[model samples]
Target: MAKAIQKITLDRSEDIPFDKLELSQKNVRNIKAGVSIEDLANDIALRGLLMSLNVRPVLGDNDEETGRYEVPAGGRRYRALELLIKQKRMAKTEPIPCIVKRGASTSVEDDSLAENVHRLQLHPLDQFRAFQTLHLQGLGEEEMAARYFVSVSTVRQRLRLASVSPRLLDLYANDEMKLEQVMAFSITNDHVRQEQVWDTVSRSHVREPYYIRRLLTEAAVRAADRRAVYVGVEAYEAAGGVVMRDLFEQDQGGWLQDPALLEQLVFEKLKTDAEALKAEEGWKWVDAAIDFPYGHASGLRRFYGERTELSADELARYDEVKAQYDKLDADYAKAEDYSEETETRLEELGNELDRLNDRPHVFDLEEVARGGVFVSLDASGELKIERGFVRPEDEPAGEVDDADDGDNDGNVGVATSVTGGISVNGKPVAVETQEEEDDKIRPLSDRVIEDLTAARTIALRNALASDPIMAFVAALHAFVLKTFFLYGSDSCLEVTMQSAKFGQTQGLGDTVGAKEIEQRHEAWGHDLPKTPAELWDYLVALDEASRQALFAHCVSLSLNAVVQPWNRRPAAIAHAEQLARSIGFDMVDAGWTPTVDNYLGRVTKAHILQAVREAKGEQSAQLIDHLKKPDMAREAARLLEGSGWLPEPLRLAVDETPAVQSNDDAAELVGDNVVEGADADLPAFLAEDADSEDAASEGAEVEEHRHLDPAE
Candidate 1:
C-alpha cells in the first residue's frame, strides 16, 4: 500500500519500547553502517532532515492507544532529528514530516514482533536476540516467517547467524566479521569451539572471511584436539613464535601447558626447525612453511633426531669469539682502504713490466760476438766472415811460424809424421774436418748477414702487408721477377730492384696517373728520390698510408668474409707512385720535374692567355678601340668619335682621322661669311658648325652661372 503523508511529531522524552517498533530486527542485516554516528550527526547538523520516517499505527489493548504509531523504517533519520530537537536547533513544537499507514490497528506486541521480524531488518546480534525470543516461544521456522512475513529460509539464516558465539557475533556487529564468516562460524554448534577459532583468527590477524571459512572447514575435518593444536600452532607462528621439535613432541603427547604458551612453544619450535632444515636441506624458512605447516614438525623431529642443548657459558664464549672475529673483519676492511693506493701503483707497475716484457728483444751485438765467430768489415764494405782459428791481415798478422810450431799444435811429426795441415791464427787446423765440427765453424759475418737478411725480410713483408698499394706493388714485383729477395742469394739487390719496379709501374702513362703522381709528390716532398730503392724506403717510412690501408683492409676483409662481392678492389693502387712502387720500378720523370704549384700556375697562365686571344678576335673593332683608348684628357676626341649616338659612317670617319679646325678667313660660311673653299655645301656646314659652337658656349655659360649663383 502507498504510504499516507502525515505530520507526526516525535516525542523526545517518550520511552517507547524498542520491541514495539515496527522495524524488523531479523532484517537488520549488517550493511557496512557507513559513516559513524558522529559523522552523520555533523551531516544532519549541516543539512536538515532529508527523509521522513515510515511508520504504522499501533493499536492499544482496547483502543486506548489506537493512535499510537511505531516506525517501520528511517530509525536512523528519526534519531538524528531527535538529536536536532534536543539541541534546540529544531523546535519540539514543529512536527516532523512522516509517512504513515492509517487505520493499521496492529497490537504493539504484534508491531514489535513485526518490526523485529518484518518491518525493519535487524543486525546479526539483534536478529540473534529476536530469534532466541521467538525460539523460546516455541515458534517453528514457518510460524515465525508467517508472523514476520518472510521466507522460512530467511528465518533459518537469521537463526543461524544468531547461533554464532557472542565473541564471533561481536565481530559481525563491529563489521570486523562478514556474513559468510558468520555462516561458516554457524557450521558448528559448540560456542566454546567457535570462540577458540575466533581467538585463533584474531591473534593471527587473518581477517579474510574466506580464510576463516577454510579454517572452519579444516577444523571440522580434523580431530578437535588436533584442530586446537593446529590453531595454536597457526596463532603461535602468527605471534612471531618459533616452534621447535621438542614442542611438537610435547604437543603430540598432550603435554601442552598454557594454550597461549602452547602457541608460543610451537612458534619457537618452528624457528629451530627452520634453522635445522635450512642447514640440512638448504631450504628457506618460507619454503619450509609452504611445504609443511604441521607435518613440518614431524620432519623437523626426524631431521634433528634429538636437540643438542647448548650451555649458557658455551653460547657466551661463542658470541665473544664471533664478536672479536667481526671486529677483526671490520678492521681489515678499513686497512684495505689504506693499502688501496699502494695496490693500484703495484698493479700499474706490474702491467708496465708485462708490456715491457712483451716487447721484442733489442739487437744484441755482444751476444752475436760471443759465438766464437767475430764480425769484421771487408775492404768492399761488405760484412766478412772468419773462422775462430783464422786472423785477418789487419789483426797484426798472428805469427805464422809460431802457428806451425810442434809444441803449439796437437799433432807431433817425427821425421814422417803428418804435416799436411795448415796453420791458421797460430793454430794448426785440419783441412778435412768432421761434418759436426765443420757445421759448427760458420763465419760470424755470414751469420750476421743471415740474421740481418731475415730481419729486413720480416720488416719489409710487414710494411708491404700494412700498405695496400705497397703490398700490391711488392707482390707484382715478386710475380714479374719470379724471385723475391728472401729467396735469392743477392737479397739486398733483389729488394732494391723490386722497389724500383714498383716506382716505374705506379707512374702509369696517363693524365690521371700523372695527377696521382703529382699529388703524391705534393704531399710527400718532390725532393725524395724517384728511384725504386728510394720509393721503397718512402713507402716504408710513409706510415700514414700504411696505417690507413691496414685499417681499411682489416675492415674490408672482415666485411668481405660475410658478404662476398667480387667487384671489391682489395689491392687498388689509388696513387700513381703506389702503382709505380708496387711494380718494383723507378718513376722516370721524363726530364720534367714540375712542382705541383708551378705546373698548376703554368697551366692557369696558358688558359688565361688563350682566353685573352680568343676575346681579342671575337670582340668588335669599336669595342677594342674603346679598350685601347687612353685617359679622357689624352683622347677627349676619341670619346665623341666613338659615341654610339653618332651615325656609323660619321663615327668611322671621325675615329679614322684627327679633327682639324677651320680658319675664319677661309670662308664666311652662312651669316659669319667665312669660306675656305668654293664648295656650295661648305657654307651650310660652316654655319651649322658655328651654330653648334654658339650652343656649346651658351650651355657652358649656363652651368657656370648656376655655380656662381650658389657661391653668391
Candidate 2:
C-alpha cells in the first residue's frame, strides 16, 4: 500500500456549446417526477448550472468525431438550456459545463443508471432548514418559493418546521419523532411549549399527531366555533387576536388564541344586531346572547302570527311550480324507477314551491308591543330570532282565563283532558267530588287527592292506550312539560327528553341535521303553552291533523339510533332500521356527506380506498391509493361528495337490522321505543363511525333520549 495506488485518469470536463449537446435515450428517468421541466428551467436560470452534465462524444457512420456530444445524464438540464436558447435568453453557442467521457469502459446507460441510483434525496429536515436559512438571508417566502420551484405555502410550511424548537428538530432528524408529529408541533412557534408537548408525548404511548395537536392547542378555541365564526377571523385579528394555523393539515380554520376577546367581540356585535333588529322589528325588547338554555322562553306566553298572504306575482310563481310538480309526479307515477333527470326536476320544483310558500309571519302591532324577542346565534353561526313571546305581566288581566277554556279538571296537574268524567267501558262515568259547603271553599288533602287521582290515572292509562288519538295527545303533554318547563312540573306522565349535546364534537352544532332539529324544537317550544297547568286544555283545542303533526314532531326527538359498544342494543338497532325503513330515511338526503373529519379521516387506509372505489370507480380510487392516509382521506371525501355515497352505518340495509324473531326481544324493542322524548338524538353522522358497519350498524356512543305520547 505504501507503493501508492494505481494512477487513474478522470473524465475531462469542458464547456461544450449548447448546440453541440443533445439528450441520449440511455437516460433512465423517462417519466416526469418531482420538479417540472419549466420549474427546473426557471430554477436553473436563477441559479446558473449547479451540477455539470455527463456527456460522451457522438460517433458518425465513419467512426470519427461528429462535433456533437450525447448527454447520458442531466438530460433535463440539457433540455432546459436548449429551451433558454430557443427563447433567445441564451446564445445557441452558449457554453454548457459538462464532463466529457472519453475512453471510458462504462456504457452510457450504466453511467446514467448509476448516477440516479446512487443519488440520495436531501433529508426533509435539511430541506426545511435550507428554506429557513434562505429566509434568514433576506429572502421572503414568496421569493424563495419562486427560486426553489415550490409553492409559497410549501416554503412557509418548511420554514415553520425549521422554526420548531431545535431540540425537537434534532429528535425529528434522528428519527425519534415522525414528520407528522413535527408538523403538529409547528402549529405554534413557542419553543418551550413545543419541547414541553414533546416531552409529554414522548413518555406516553398515545403520540398520535391528533393527540399531539390536542395537547398543544387544548386551551385554544377553534376558529370554526360559533363565536369565532360570528366575529370572523379578520375581525378577530383586527382586534389583535392571534390564530394558530397548521399549514400541513386541515385545522378546521385554525385555533383562536383569545376566547375572552372572541366572546367580547361576539357580544358586542350581537348587541349591535339586537338593537338594530329591535328597532326595526318593533319588539318591546330584544335579548342577545351567544346561546341560551334550550327553552329560555319556557315561562313566557308565545303568540303565533299569521303569515302575510302572497302577492300576485308570488302566487303565480307558486302556481307554476305546483303545476310542474304535479305534472312530474303524474309522469313518474307509473314508472318502476325514476330517471335521475326526473328526480332532479321534481326536487327542484318541490324546493321552489317550498320557498314560495314560506311567507314570513307578520305579527300584529299590538302583540309586538307587549312581546319581546330572543336573539341568539344558531348552530350555523347565523342569528336566530325567536319572536312573539309575551311575559305573564305583559298580558292584559284575565285576557287568558282558566274557566273560559273547556276543561273542568279541578286540579291543574291532571295529566288527562277527559272533559268531565273518566271514560269507562266506552262511556263517560262522572265521579262525585266533595265541594265546600261554606263561602270559603276548602280542598281535599294531598294524600286523599293523590289516592283518588292514582286510581283515575290507572283508568286513564288503560282507556287511552286503547284510543290511539288520546294516547298521542297524552305523550305530547308530557313532551311539552319536559321541553318547556325544566324547573317546574305538573304533568302526571313521567316522560323525559334530553337533547344529547355535542359540545366536544367539532362543527357538529353547525351541521344541517343539528340546525333543522334545533329550529323544529324551538318552533314547537314557542308555540306550546307556557306552563304545564295549561298544557291539557291547550292541546285539546288543536285540530286532529295539527295534534297528530305535533305528536309526530314530539315523538321524533327521542330517536337514539346511535350504536355504542358498551351498551349493545341489537334489538334497538334493528328497531331504528325498521323506523328508517318506515320513513324512507336516507342519511344522504339528510345532508350528511362523507367528510375527512367526520368519516374517512377516522378509518384505516383500506377503508378510505374502498369508499372511493365504491363511490367513484377503481381507477379513481387507484389515483389516490398511493397517497398518505390524510391525503387519501381528503381526496376520498371530495370524490364521495354529491355522489350520494353512504358509509355502512348510514346505509339502510335492504332486509333489516337482522333477527328480532325472539318475542322477548320484540316486546323489549317496543317498550324501549315507547319511551321516545322531545329532544332529537344525534343523527348518524355516521357519529364517531367508531364501530364496524359490517359488525354493527350506526355504532354511536350510548346516550339517552326521552319522550311522551297521548291517548284518544
Candidate 3:
C-alpha cells in the first residue's frame, strides 16, 4: 500500500491538531517542560525547528468563534513561536510546516496511542517523565502499558524510576549516571541505597556504560547488605565461585578484597577435607612408574590378587595415558619452564591420582595371611583380613608385674637409707660418707676501703659546698673551736681578733662589731667541742662557717655601697672601721690606709667637683691634672664631656683627634701634645667642645663616661 501524503496549511497554534495526532494522551505522557519558555524561544531562534510537528485535520467545519486551530504534539514549538512573534522576530501570519493525518477514521485517543506505541522511541528518562505525566493525568499503569504497547512491568519500572528521590533523578538528568544505573539503584526503594549508588557512580571515572551499571549495581547491593562491600574480581571467589587458576592468579578485585582471610579460609578447608580423606583410607602405595612401550605400566606392583585380574590391554591403555601425563609433569617440573598453568594442571592430575588410588581392591585372605597379614574370625564367623608387610597384631605387648618396680629388673631390690648417720635403736650403723674440704677466706683490701672512703668524702664535700653561707658558718665554728682547744678560754678573743683581721683585709673595717662577731662565732661554734677530735669536727664545719661569714661581709658591703649617698664617701670608710672594731682589729693593720679611705671619699667628692666645675664653665685644675694622667685622662675626658664641661669646639676637637693625627706629623703632634695646651685654652675651647660633644653623645651614653670616679 502506498503511503498517504498530504499538504497542510494550519494556524501556528492549530496546525498540529490534537485529534489527528498519533501520540496518545498516555504516549504524550508527561510533557515535562524541563527548560523555560524563554530557553525554548532562544533555541528556536538559533537552531530553528529540528523536529517536524505531528498534527491532525480539524473535524467537521473549522471553528467559527476563533480563527485558529488547536495544537497536538507541537505545543512547546507553538509557544516558542508565539514568544518570537510577540517580540516582532516572526510574523503573526507565518505558516509552520507540519505533517497532518485525516481525522475521519481515527479517534484522537487512538491516533495518540498509535504514535507513542509504534512511531516514537523515547529515552528511559523521557519515557519515565511521560509515564509520570499520564499517571498524574489519572491513567492506570495497565491501561498506559496496553495503550503504549509496553509491558505493565516496564511501565511500572519507568514510573518507579521517575518516583526516585529528586537527588538521584538529578544525577540521571545531569548525565552523572545512566538510566540503567538509576534503574538498578531503584530496585531497593531505599533513599540511602539510591544515594550510595549515586555517590559511587558519580565519584568513579568509569566512562564505559557497562562499568557504571556494574558499579551502581554492586553499590546498591552493598548498601542493602550494610556490610563491608567487596567488589571487583576478588568478590567472585570470596562468594564461593569457582575460578580458573589463571583468573585466580590475576590481581582481580575478588581476591584483592581480603587476600589473607580468603587464602586462610580456602587452605584451611582444603586441609580439613584432605585430613578427613586421609583418615577414611588406610595408607597404601600405588605404582607411580610409567611404562616405556606401555607407558606408565613399567613399575613393580604389590597389590592384592584381585587387582591383577584386569586385562593387559586395559593396563597398557592406562599406561599410555599415564605416560603422557608423566611427560607433561616432567616438563612442568623444570624450574625455568614452571608456571601457574603447569602447577594447576599438576594439582589436578595429582588429585585425580589420589582419587584413583583411594578405590578398594579385593584380595585372597589365606595367601596374604601367611605373609604376616592377620586373619580373624568374628562372632558371626565372617573372616576378615589385614594386609601389610608388618602386622601390628604380631608385635609383643609390654607387661608390668609390680607398679613399684618401675625398671622391671627381676633381681634388683630397693632399700631405705638415712642421711647424716644411720641409727637403729640409738646405736650408730655403718654408712657411706664423704669428706668436707676447707676453703680459704680473704678480707677486703685497703684499696677497696679507700674507694669507699673517697666516695664518702665526695658526698660530704658536696653537702658542705652546696651553700656559701653554710661554708662560712662552718669555717667560723672551726676557727673558734680550734682556738678554744689550743688556748682554752682565750678562744673568744682570738676569734674576735681573726674576724677583725679578716674584716680589715676586706676593707670593711669597724662596721662589723666585736659583739656581732662573738655572737656569730657562738652561734656557729656552739655545736663544736674543745677536744682535738672536736677540733677535727670543727674543721669539717669551718668550710660552711667561712662561706657564711664571707657572704655576710659581702652583703654588708653592698648595703653600705648602695645606701651611702654620692657625697658620703666617708660613710663606707666609717662603716669599714666599725666592722674592723667588731673583729678586734685596727683598720690600718688590715690594709686600710688613711689614703685609701680618703681616695674613696674623693670618689664621692669628685662627682660633685666635676658637676660644679661643669656648671662654672671653668675646669678645676686639680681635677683636670688628676685626669690628665694616662690612665685617668680618657676617663676624665669622658666625665667632663658627659657633664657638659667642654663646649662644642673642644668637643669636636676631641672627637676629631684621630683625624687630626692622620692629617700630618704636625696634626699628630697637635692631638698628642696639645692636651696641656688644650687645657690652657679651656676658657675659649670648652664652650665649642661641650656643644659638639653633647650632640655627639645624644643617642646612648657611654656607661664608662657616666660615672666620674673610676673606682666607682
Better of 2 and 3 by lDDT: 2
Q: Candidate 1: deviation at residue 347, Å?
A: 92
Superposition TM-score, candidate 1 onto the true structure? 0.18
Candidate 3 lDDT by residue in tens digits, 613-689: 55444455343433212223333433444343422111212122234444466665432343222233221221122
Q: Best TM-score goes to which candidate?
A: 2
Q: Summarize candidate 2's per-residue lDDT along 1-712 as a digit string, tens digits.
A: 4887799888888999888988999899898888877877877888899999999999989888898999999988888888888778889998988999987898988999999999999999999988888899999988887787778999889999899999998988899989989999989888998889888767755578976787788779998887788889999999999899999988889999888898889877976787788778888767666765333454466776766889999998888889989988998998898599998999999988888877787778998988877777875688887788776657788876664353322211121122121111111233433332222212222222232222222222222323345445545655674576453233333345432222223444445555555565567765776568999998999888777666655554444444333322333444444445544556666566778766666556776777888889998988776665665676687688899986665566566335447777667644324433211222233222233323333222222211112210
TM-scores, one per candidate: 0.18, 0.58, 0.20
Candidate 2: stretches off by over 4 Å: 1-12, 18-33, 56-70, 85-89, 101-110, 136-142, 311-356, 398-712
On residues 1-712, what C-alpha lDDT tens digit does candidate 1 reach at each position? Answer: 9998999764233333323444424234335464444545556676655655556656677755565556655656656656666777766555555566555565434543555366455565786679878987898989777555567877876777777788878878899777677776665566887788677767653345544544444322222244234445456446553332111112232222235554334335434443443344322111211011101111010111122344586566556655655565566567736666655655564554444334332212322222112122222222222212221221224423453333212211111111122111121222322112121222222222222222222223333333566454443543553343222211122333222111111112122323333234233333234344666676567678554554323221111100011111111111212322343422122122222221212122222222223333323223322221111112222222222221110011112112564775334443222111112211121112112235776587456544532221
Predicted candidate 3: what Cα RMSD to the true structure?
42.0
State the weakest 10-residue window (summed lDDT) of model 1. Answer: 293-302
What is the model-wide C-alpha lDDT for candidate 1? 0.38
Sort the predicted structures by TM-score, highest score first. 2, 3, 1
